[model samples]
Target: MKKCISFLTVCLLMAKLTTAQIIPSFEFGVKGGMNLSRFSHTATFATENRAGYLGGIYARAGGLGFNFQPELYITSKSVTVNSGSTQNKATFTSIDLPLLLGTKIGAFGVGGRFYTGPLVSFAINKDQNVGDALGNALHLNYKDQNLAWTFGAGLDLKKVSIDFRYEYGLTKQPYNNGNDETRINLFNLTLGYRLFSL
Candidate 1:
């Protein structure tokens, strides 16, 4: 309940900022790319790295060396687990909201920007089939909501942009046992094109 309230407060603050805004330029775009993800598990669980996908749309509003970016995107995380002779894989999906405040620096031809912000994510779906080789499947329950931080840099040239980012999960995911937990962490590279500029 506290987390939900905090999120609401952040939203209200952003709304207030928007009402007083005077941005010189606004650009809307689509981005998609591959992500390499892994789980940082406690001593009770062993896990490996796996690959996933991420894609989303974003709007950037600002100019004159600064920008405010807000995005709504879908992200995926995967991990590999080994238990005895059985190697299992699990993937989870979530919706991510990122609010970024940063500055851009470049010349007449291209622009480069670095941004850092908080990410609020909600897990929507997951696919896990652990312990299947042992004749039964194990169930894992994780929290639906999570908080994270992202920092990255990107370059914009013409209508194309590319960026690299790292996200560290602040909230840990817990299994049914409660004592066992894992935090999702990953690095992502994305390529985007401006579909429209407003």
Candidate 2:
């Protein structure tokens, strides 16, 4: 009887450990990447896309199948604008906050993830130079706060992650004294590594 009881108790403990291994958990990481961004509007000035850099930290909850992630990053966005014969750049430096929900599929330390979320951005530099021609013509005024929706897919191999995402602006910044507005769009690619798991 003692032998049988000991065997059953060990089996139960092993089962509990197996269950914990399959359950979702928490992780935190850091990421950095580049972004290609452009402005969208009906303005007469021609706009061109520009590349910029971003770096940040992210925390994720849940794993195995589903996860919720929140990230904070600093990003630089820019566009080159041409007004007839003159050309200049308009750049914005901002802090970004993104909240995302994602699903993961795969096994054996490798997986693919798809996520979508909302992002809020606060501009660190409110003044933008559009050149004398475009600035005088549009009387551009930039807003301090902006919002967007982002969607992305990623690949995870062990502790490394790579993601590609698109951000579509939902709010417009007014120019010409609130009479005209424009939105910003971006494509982002990032590489991240897990710092730890809990």
Give all candidates' CA lDDT scores.
0.74, 0.79
Tens-digit lDDT track for model 1 on 56-122?
8988888655789887677778888665677767777776777788877654337788999987776
Candidate 2: clashing pairs of residues? none
- In order of listing, the candidates' clash counts read 0, 0
Q: Estimate each model's TM-score.
A: 0.73, 0.76
Q: Which regions of candidate 2 fall more than 4 Å away from where they truly are?
A: 1-22, 126-144, 174-180
Per-residue error for 30 in candidate 2, Å, reads 0.5
